[model samples]
Target: MTKAFASQGDLTEKKITFDEVGRDLWAFTAEGDPNSGVIIGDDSVMIVEAQATPRLAAKVIEKVREVTDKPISHVVLTHYHAVRVLGASAYGASQIVMSEAARAMVAERGQEDWDSEFQRFPRLFEGHESIPGLTWPTTTFNDRMTVYLGRRRVDIMRLGRAHTAGDAVIYVPDANVMFTGDIVEDHSACYCGDGHFHDWPGTLDRIRAFDLDAIAPGRGGALIGSDRVNGAIEATRDFVRSTYRPAARVALRGGTLREAWEAVRAECDPKFGDYAIYEHCLPFNVARAYDEALDIDTPRIWTAERDLAMWAALQG
Candidate 1:
């Protein structure tokens, strides 16, 4: 049997932090785990990112309780990813919100994605049995929408697609902070399994235009200063450019997937070797990049069976 570590392992839950950026804006981040954000309004609260499961989400809720007693009336999904939106039920939210494109992506491949991700990282789905079903958005906007948290304003915008076809950023203009769901990662590897390599840089440019002083990325710690925020965006962009572009070039040149993976490892490892999820992300990243380089608009589904088959083909 695979042994679990004493202090930590994939399944180990990390401590949650209630990072206060301003009076009412806060970030609930697990130690380098998937992070969530809390926005407290005059009379209500909104949760950004629902987490992987209800059990995992409760940890975030616990942090939220430490700051406010307002009922969580809105759950915003920056994008449709199993790890980010599956825990909506735990929030007991009045209305769950997502971009129109995100909702469409959920409808298109939500089930396949849930299966693929669970297969890739079984440890993250500790209490898989508790998941009620696919999370559906109660409300979805086409491009941009704004919400008022008492007198404070929160803007949810589907700026452009990068990490996913429907990537969104939650902007707290008052605090000059933004919650970039997978669009901006701080010291964490970009999971390009379902990403757009070519358009991702442009998306990062859109995020950089925010003039954000602070940012809570989809993974890693909260960036606290404007310089750090810019660093996060640049780092994330560099990962995409350095890792996937060469992989795409190799694939387009008729190089094998194994060859492409090797190219990426050699090129990226010297830089991002220690970043979280780099090893696990590379194979899928190469596969998706290969497809996109060939003009595949949508990423192909990754079933467990397909994952192994691809791994075996690349590994051999």
Candidate 2:
């Protein structure tokens, strides 16, 4: 072990911000850390993207309590990631909602992902022992599902794959606000450990078609205006494109994995080096980009052993 694993050295606590993006829509952002969106309706609330654990989620719970006493009736997982879905139990939402693809991923590799992410990001999993087990969704939808929070409509749609096979977004038509989980990041590195790089740009195009006034991205501060929303989308698209294009080109030319990694670092580091988790995400991002460029459609499951191996290969 030459260098620390993903985000292991990132132990400094980030400042969390709970910004009201709409009348009842809130974004709980922690600098460049994972974010959670809160939608308060007439009588109840819906949480999007749970934190890493119950103890970590309690911070968000405290924020939720400050604004409203509404019971969290629904919890929506934008994708099947340990850091995003494991804290779902803390909300105690009766119906945990996600896409059918996400449910399958959870069933297939949820435990492995949990262990893998815990090792990669120990700071985020402050209370790893508190996690009862793998979080499972109570309800699953194919393409889209609309849930009413007392007349407020929150449309959850799987608008193609970017971050994962089952990446979904929560769109509020009335509020013109969209909650994109890792699909559109701002001033942060997009973790492409399990991403679909080839299809990600098209997904971003689909998201751009929406008439959104504000956006609550998975990381970074909430985008407040339409311009900022568009900027975030473009930034995310650029990051994905800049990262994958060079690696894919290297792979297409039958270059080695290290060559692909070097290509990406040479092209992207100048622009994205200062972003959070840039170093942590580089190897995995390059690996996926290399695979996708070689026509591998689905992302392979990431295990703890694989994480170490990949890190050692790239970093050592």
Candidate 3:
């Protein structure tokens, strides 16, 4: 029998964990569900990634309230994925920030991504009706920008492309922690449907260069310490490389997409089958890898119609 399309069958709720990775930085993770970060600055707080919807974000808010009452001053989006940005409204922050490329993605394929993701992973969009609309960045920077929460400096930088073209990583200088949006995941699968596989390792290298003390990764538990941080970064690199190599080999040999799919499964499943969302991400990862290997510089847009068609073809 065919597997359920994407994560549609994943209806069970995951237990949430709010742990401090840095002095005042907290990671909100839910048993491999999409994770968000809380950076409590001198006078206010900065949320790293907004959950899929306001309802999901409210859970993050509740965790934040338990510790401090400082107002949320900024909501920084690491990229333009619907599951990452659609919940911006719930923050009530003065500024919503993104990289220049991320904002362009919002204008270009934001709605399509929203529709496609809602269909692919219904569990993440549990309170879909509460979404105000497509989340837009009120503030945007090209490469790097710094914000001061009353002397606590948070550096938001577009290190390099990995998870998405516009991926951003927020660094807390005082605490030596970084909120690496899907560019680094702790025991969670990297969703590579819109990734740049060739450049992903370079991006990982840039992140590794920091020798960060801690990291609040995209979709797993908080990573604290140099050893654990480096381990997660390398593990993500391994997952990306493992998924791309086999698919690239198939694509270069002029194999069909289905052939690439099987090749990727054979290579990745043994190592990553038990990872969170590994199966949900495998097909898209292979498709993107195949295209990239064929020298497709940019990823093709993923829509709901195209999603179903791709799934059907792979199944056949």
| Collision count for each candidate, in order | 1, 0, 0
The stretch of ten residues in a row with the least summed lDDT in candidate 1 is 1-10
Sort all candidates by TM-score, best to worst. Answer: 3, 2, 1
| Native-to-model Cα distance after best TM-score fit, residue 5 in candidate 3, in Å | 0.9
> Candidate 3, TM-score vs. the true structure?
0.99
lDDT of 1: 0.83
Q: lDDT of all predictions, in order shown?
A: 0.83, 0.93, 0.92
**Candidate 2 lDDT for residue 110:** 94
For model 1, how does the per-residue alpha-carbon lDDT over 1-316 read when each residue is reduced to its tens digit? 4222211246655676778866687887766667899888889998999988998788888888888898998999999989898989999998999999999988898988888778766766767789999999998999999988778798999878788989889998878888888988877788887898888999899888878888989988888888888988998988998877788889888988788888888889899878876666777778888888889988887776787777666643
The worst-scoring run of ten residues by lDDT in candidate 2 lies at 1-10
Model 2, span 157-203: residue lDDT tens: 99999999999999999998999999999999999979998789999
Question: What's each prediction's TM-score?
Answer: 0.94, 0.98, 0.99
Worst 10 residues of 3 by lDDT: 307-316
Model 3 stretches with alpha carbons more than 4 Å out: none
